[model samples]
Target: MGIVIKQSIKNTIITFIGFGIGAVNTLFMYPYFLGEDYFGLSGYVLSAANILYPIMSFGIQNTLIKFFNENNKTEHELNSYITYMLLIPLVFIIPLTGLFYFNYDTIAAYESQKNPIIYSFVWVIPLIAIFMGYFEIFYAWLRAHMQSVFGSFVKEVFVRLLISVLLFGVYFKYITPLEFIYSLVFVYGMSLLLIVFYANKIKRIVLRFKVPKQSKAIWTYTIFIILSASIANMLLDIDKYMIKHYMDIDNIAFYSVAIFIAMVISVPSRAMHQITYPITAKLMSEQKWEELNELYKKTSITLQVIGGLILVGILVNINQLYLLLPKEYSQGLFVVFTIGLSKYFDLILGNNNAIIFNSKYYKAVLSLGIVLVLLIVLLNMYFIPHFGLNGAAFATLIAITLYSLAKLLFVVLRMKLFPFTYKTIVALGVVLISFFAFYYWDFSFHPMLNIICKSILVSIFYLGLCHVLKISSDINFVMRSIFNKVFKKQ
Candidate 1:
């Protein structure tokens, strides 16, 4: 647990650094520099690329991690195992490009525009897809070696940094919007190259065609994981794809802006999950069921607390937040809340997927992920036409909620594990009370001061309530330690 906390802290700092870098690009730079349609196109292109990423790579990313951890093979052997497993996906996907080539018109038909920008850009899809597949496998290698920071840095930091530069160039009228969108392929390719270079720094990274002693088990797991990974990604990416089909890139931009804000609430969960994956692998390897169960509870409590705070903060100041965006994008306010809530639910399910995936029931995670994929697509199809941006938000919310619930119920039903107690209930109560009190607070005078004062008031009131209930005594200790440190300085 100490290791989990420490590594998670490192990941937290990395995630925030990445988040800050991304916020600059997403919130200020891109929105300010790019027009709505272009901004929307950038968002849609990325959403499409990422949504396609998992399938293009198959389940090979997660498969690499699990297999590498299990076998403890040599450098060449490990590389061969993963490199070969990865080749199978390319084999099928590469040939299918010819098929996709013939159906290019059908693909562009969904793009809101019937032009070369949409049609020509279709070629980049496979490049982006192949880039993503390689990147994920390399990242999994780093992760398997307990090197999350490099992967985090490359994914969260370097890629965004490159994108930021592109946006800045556009801001100065040095590049056109269409060209900027096309630059995504290069940006991603460079990012992939960076990860490969960094992976070499930490360990040997090469593409040797050495044949691996194939195992039937590995192939089976990979197939299951591929199915799971593809669906999981579809659930995450379907909204961006659907919006472009149903509406225009303008709405995609609006909703993407809202999602960028909403994603802040889940950043910590993603960081923690990185640590949890390796730890779960370790625990399951040792058959430490007891510790795994306890981890489930503590991780859930801590993540939900942190996530709830960020969510509340975002929801409370949403109006002020949109004041930072363009006037047209201010309409995405409700989308922020819906997506933030979805992230909070994800926070509460911390390490749940890791636990299930690392355990004997790894296949079940895929089953649930597939179910949610269908749910998300159906929900988005139903909502986007009726409600527009809000509809997309609601669809994501429904999908993630069901996904989380399914994982939670699976853990409890099959494993007899639960992440609840009286303290959990009290903590949730505190969250509710704090949200209602602060969510509707009147904004007046200095906006920053009002935010600070109301947040402090909420903090004090919530802690007071917690002290009365003895909910999360860790919070009490944290407060006392902070005061002690501050007073000691005085």
Candidate 2:
């Protein structure tokens, strides 16, 4: 766990810094600088592209991690394997490119029925999708080599920083709204290039046409994962995409702000998963069930503790935080609460995704993901027309809850492993207690001050309780280490 902790802390810091910049962009710059309509348009374009990139990449990103292991493969075999990873995506990318080129008018018309402004940006979707697809493939390549920090920085910090600069460009009238939208293609393209350069520096990618022995299994997993990845991405971005059908494009911007607030709860999980994912894959590959289960439990509680603090902090300070946003944007309060809760549920699952994806029963889980995507789409279809933005949040919460439970049950039943323990219950107790304790009481200070004060109170109360109850020894150790260092310096 030494390397895990060391890297996770670094990744956590990096992710938070990224989210900090992202918070500014999502919360302030996009709203104020670009105005709501273009902000929503930008959000819509990116969401659409996110939904498409998995199919374009053909799941090579995840496949790389699941398969790459130095213990089992020679350098030649590894090169052949990576060569296959590179080529498989072209099989999808080329056909999709041709389809988009020929049928773009039809595609654009269908998507932009409610918002004609979206039609012009439709071509950019596949272009950015191509960039995003390759970026993840290369990022996965780095993670396979257990070198994720630089890639994490590139993904989390670098991309958001570029968005900030671009948003400022829009602010100063240096870039037209359309130019700003088009610049996204260049931003993601440059991002992919940076990751590719770093990946090459780690190990020069060599092309070898020799087919790996596990070609059969590899293709099978890739096919299922492509569908699975597509479904997963759809589940995330479909609400934003579908919103255009039921609501104004500006509503997407409102919904995105709330979603971004909720998404901060996921940063710790994202940071930890970068390191833990490949580790989980290796553990499962080695058939080290004991260590695997132990890791499962530790990661669950640790993330629960960290994610819980963020969730509690957000929920308790939500009202004051919303006060800081434009009055129109505050309509997403329920969206924040609902999606924040769902994200917290997801965080507590620890490396559940990594475990399941690396397991043999992945095909079954993929089926569940398909059902979830359909369910979410149907729910959004029915709910959005009636309840508007909150309805989308409701649909996501329900779909995520049901899907998370199903995955948990499948893992327990199939593998006889569980992520919960007595500590989990204690951690939940701490979270609930902290929320109830601080939520009803707020300083009569400025909204920002109220949020800062309330957040500090919530953090102290929540983390202090965790320390007392010992919800996660890993967290407690870090807390103690910080305290010891502070006192020593004094």
Candidate 3:
């Protein structure tokens, strides 16, 4: 818990810095500098690549974490394991590359049916996908060694800061829109290189051709992971892809802005997961059920308290935040609310995903993910036509809510574990009370100042209530430490 708390707090700070930069980019630069059409095009290209990278990596990223800490393995066996992780993705990447090369024009034509500018950038998808795939692979390698802060910095801060520079290049008339789009390939490639370098510095990656004794289990897990991961990514990015087909490309940009706001709620979950995932894997592998259940509750409440504050802050200040955006972008307010609620639900699940993925019943969860993807796609098709951007968001909310519930039930029923207690209920109460209390009480000032004042108010009120209620001792401990440092300085 000490290392988890220490690294998670560091990762949280790093992630916030990254998201701050990202908020500037997503909320301001992309919209104003690039214009809506190219912004939408950029969003489309990235979404399509996100959907593809899971298959390209062949699930080696996840497999690396799950299998890396196998007990009683010699140095030679470990090297062999790492070697297999390195080489397995080539099985999918090579064939896919050849396929894309031969049928490039036909695929481009299909993608460009609704949005023609997308035709020229079609080839960039697989190139960036390759970069993203290996980046995750190397990041997972670091996580296996219980080293994630540098990778977090690289991923959360480094790549985004580069993108900001590229955005500025466009603003200063130095790069064409097409060049900016193409520059993303270089950005992701550099990110991959940095993570790979850092991973090697931690442990030199040696390639040994000999397969481990658990080769059969490894292959089985990898195959399941590939299918499961593909389905999961589809559930996330499919709405954007569907939007490109059904709506104007500019609509993707509008929806992306709202989605970005909603995504901030998940930052705590993301920061904590980087550390908890490998720990969850280790515990399950060792069959430490009691310790695993305790971690489950602790992570759930901790994330809930942190994530709830973020959600409440966003909801209460959503109107003022939108006033800062272009009028056309305000159409996504419902999108923000709908998706924000869904993301909050996901945040409260703690390490539910890690538990399911590492458990033997992972196949069942994979089947459930497949069904949810189909459900989301169908809902998007039906709703986007009738309701537009809000429709896509609503469909996502339904699918994600159902998906979260399914995972929760599967974990509880199968493993007889749950991630709730009285504190969970108290956290929810505090969030709801804060939202209702501050939502309609905006100050009569400039929108930026109003947001600042209101956000501070919400934080103090939210954290104050959490402290009084003792919702999370971990969070309370952190708060006391900060106060102690501040008063000592004074």
Candidate 4:
């Protein structure tokens, strides 16, 4: 737990800093520099590429982490395992590349009718997909070695920092919009090379032709995870994909701003999961059910409280946030609330997804994930045409809520592990009251100043109350540590 907390804090700091840069890129720079169509095109390309990333990697990113620490093997055996992980994805990626190549014209014809900007940049999708796949391949390599912080920093911070510089180049008229889009491919390609270099720098990877002795089990798990990855990608990326279909490509830019704002709440979970997944897998492998259950509840409570504060801040400040953005994007006001709450729901689940994915019941969860993807797609199809962007936000909110609840119930029923308590109820009550109290109260000042005041007051009140009530041991520990350090300095 000490190592987990230490590294999680490190990763969390890195991720939020990255998100800070991303918020600038997403809300201000991209909108101002690229304008809406190109901004949306960038979003569309990335979202579409994400949809293909799972297939390209063949789920090796997750499979590597799940199986890496299962047992110790000789260097020869480990090298053989590396060979399988590296080469197997190409068996899937290459053919998909070919499929995209041959069907390029037909696909472009359909997409251009809806958003012709997609036509010029359609090829970048497969290229970015391949880049993303390899990036994760190396990222998981470092993660399996329990060196996640550096890799996470590179992925979260370095990549966004690169994007910021490139967008500024576009702002200064040093590059055309089309070229700016192409530069993104270069950014991802460079990121991939750096991660690959870092992985080798950590431990020289040796790829061998021999397969592991558990080749049969490895293949089965890899296939299952491939399906799981596809399902997961669809849930996360389908909204942008569908938005492109139903509305102008520019709408994606607006939707993306709201989505990014909402997504800030999930940063803690995202940072924590990188370290927690391998730890969870190790615990499950050791059959330390008690420790695993304790980890589950602690994560749930800590994330719930933190996620609650972020949600409050975002929702209460959403108006001022949109004020900073162009008027065109201000339409996504409801989009932020719906999507933000959905993300909060995801946060409170903690590492439940990791727990389920690493457990023996993974296959069942994979089945449910498939159903979730289908539901999300269907919901988007149904809701977008009738309700517009808000409808898409509603679709996501519904799908994520139902999907998370289902996962929660499955874990409870099958493993007899419930990540809930009297504090869970109290935490919910605290969140609701905080939201209602500060939501209607505003100061007569500049919008930004008002946002700052409300955010500070809400955070202080909410966190102070949580501390007084002793809602979470993890939060209390963190706060006490801060106080101790402060008093020591005094």
Candidate 5:
């Protein structure tokens, strides 16, 4: 818990700074400078790259985290493991590169009919995907060593900062929009190099290139991770992919904006999970089920209390947020609500994903993930043409809700532990009451001013209730530290 909290706090600060830069890039720079079509084009290309990342990396990132600490192997054996992590992904990467090269024209012919810009730079997706794959691979390498802050900063902060500078270049006519788009590929490539450099700095990695004793199990885990990661990425990115197919790519820009707003709610979970995952793996290896269960409940309530506050903040002030965006993006109001709810629900599940994925029951969830992927694709296909962007959001909300519930149930039934308790109920009740209390309240001030005032008041009201009710010891610990500092100053 000490390491988890320490790194998570660091990760949280870095992630917030990253998202703040990203918000300016997404909400202000991209739309203002790139315009809707190019913004949508950027969104589509990145989403496409994200979908390709799972395939390119072959799940080496997850495999490394799960297996790295489970054994006390020799240096040679560890080197062997690292070599396999580096090499095995090429099994898919090489062939996919070849396939893209040979069939790019035919693929572009089909997609370019929808957006001809895609045909011109169709190769960028695979390029950026390959780069991001290595980025994650090295990031996992550092994370397994319990050194995640630098990697998180690189991933969440450095990349966005680069993008911000690049967007400014485009705005000042120092770079054309096409140049800006191509620079994105370069940015991802640079990120890979940076992570690789940092990873080597931490532990001068040597590749022994020998087979480890656990080769068979490592391969088995990698295969399942590949399947699971593919399914998960498909569920997350397919909406943007499908949106391009059904409507003009510009709609993807609007949808991306909404999704970004909703995704901020998941940052705390994302930050914490990066550190907690290996710990959960360690716990499972040690067969500490009781300790694991308690960790699970604590994470659930803490994330719920935090995510619930953000969710209410987003939902209550969504209209004011839209007012800040271009009028064309106003259609995404419901998109924010639905996707925000989905993310908050995911946060409430806490470390259930880490627990399940690290346990031997991981393959069961892989099976479930496959089903949900198929279901999400079908739902998106059926709904997007019918309800448009909002329909895609709805499809995601339903698929994710069902997927999370199934995982939670599996953990509960199989392990006899649940993430929810009386505190969970109280935290949710506070969220709803806070929403109703402040949502309809209006101000004569400017929209931005109104948003700020409402957000501060709601956070005060909601967090006050959670502290009073003792919803989470972690939350109280943080509050106590703050109060102690303030009173000591007085």
Candidate 6:
């Protein structure tokens, strides 16, 4: 536990650094410098890349994890499988690139505020997708082998920092916004090379260039996993694409802004999930069902506590948040709750999807993922027409909660495991108390200053409340052990 905390502290610091740059880029500079419409365009371009992501890669990312860890697949066999998997994108990439080259003008013919540079980069999407897929799989390989911090830092921290530099060039007029945005796709390609380098530095990921023998059963599983992953990604990202057709770019910008902030609610859980994955895999390898169950409950509560604080902090002071943004972004306030709730539900279901994916019941995961995607689309269709962005928000909230609850229900019934307990409610109380305390107090300062001050006040109140509630006892036990080691060294 002490070791986990030491490592988690480092990961958390780096993750927050990434989040800081991302928050500034997405929320402030993108909105302030690029303007709402172009910001929306930027959002759309990234969304389109993500939407194409799972398709171009052909589930190679997931296939790598499943294959690499299986002893039956020799190191050479694993490399061959991965090599074939990476090449799988060529099948779609050739056609997609040709399509873009021939019909780009026709494809870019939307009501979008036109930029020829953007269309030029449309070809980069499939190319970038090919490498991004390989990059993610390579990162996952590092993860499976219990080297999560570097992978997480590379992913959550470094990539976004590089993006901030690119955007800074645009803001300073050193590069045209078009060039800056166009370079965005290339950043992904660059990231792939970095990941490959890091993975090799840690332990050689054999890169044999030949296909391996796999039975008919393996192909069936591979196909199912790819289709399942593709469908699931569509559910997450299709909203951004659909908004372009039904609404204006400014509205899309606002919705994207709101979702971006709301996603901050889920970052801690996401970072923690990376570290938890290989540990979960280790348990699965050993057939430690009871330990796995205990870990699940602990992991869920830890995420819920952290996630609950974030959601509470955001909602309680969202008015002040909008005060910092431009007037057009004020409309996003109502949607923040919906988006925040969606991420909250996802956080509470910590590692559930990974658990299912690692288990023999993975087919159920694919089937359920498809069903959830359909539900989200149907809900978005119904809501986007009537409520506009707010409607989209409600639809997202409903879809995410429903999707998460379904996974939780599956885990409970099939595996006889549930992650709720009295400790969970206590943690919720701690966050809620801090939320109201910081929210209601008047801080005589600038909006940015108020933001910083309010955040500090919240932290102090929350930590103080933890002490009063005896949560400090459990935490101190961990801290004391950490310091004991330091003292002995001294």
TM-score of each predicted structure versus truth: 0.91, 0.98, 0.99, 0.98, 0.98, 0.89
- The TM-score-based order of candidates, best leading, equals 3, 2, 5, 4, 1, 6
lDDT of 1 by residue, 88-129 (tens): 677668777778789878866656452234555666777787
Cα RMSD for candidate 1?
2.8
After superposing candidate 1 on the true structure, give the runs of residues whose Cα lies further than 4 Å from its correct spot. 73-76, 110-117, 206-214, 446-490
lDDT per residue for candidate 2 within 172-273, as digits (tens), equals 989988899999999999999999999999988888898887888889999998998898788778999999998989999999999999999999999999
Candidate number with greatest lDDT: 3
Clashing pairs in 6: none
lDDT of 3: 0.93
Alpha-carbon RMSD, candidate 6 = 3.2
Evaluated at residue 225, the lDDT of candidate 3 is: 89
> What is the per-residue lDDT of model 4 for residues 1-490, given as tens digits with 9 covering 90 to 100?
8878888889899999999999889988999999999999999999999998888888998888888874247888778887788998999887888988999998888777888778978899889888999899888888778888988888899999999999999989899888989998998998999999999999788878987777787788889988988887878889999998889889999999989999899989988888888898889888999999999999999899988989988887888767777888898999988988888888888889888888888888887888888889999999999999999999989888888899999999999888988998899888998989888767888888998899999999999989999999988999999999999999
List the global CA lDDT of all models: 0.77, 0.92, 0.93, 0.88, 0.89, 0.73
Clash pairs (backbone) in predicted model 1: none
Question: Candidate 4's C-alpha lDDT?
Answer: 0.88
Task: At residue 120, give the lDDT of candidate 6.
Answer: 51
Per-residue lDDT of model 3, residues 271-339, tens digit only: 999999999999998999999999999999999999999999999999999999999999999999999
Give the runs in model 2 whose Cα sits over 4 Å from its true position. 70-72
Tell me how candidate 5 scores on lDDT: 0.89
Question: What digit string (tens of lDDT, one per residue) describes model 6 on residues 338-396?
Answer: 88877887888767876776677778777777777888788888888888989888877
Lowest lDDT sum, 10 consecutive residues, model 2, at: 69-78
Ranking by lDDT: 3, 2, 5, 4, 1, 6
lDDT of 1: 0.77
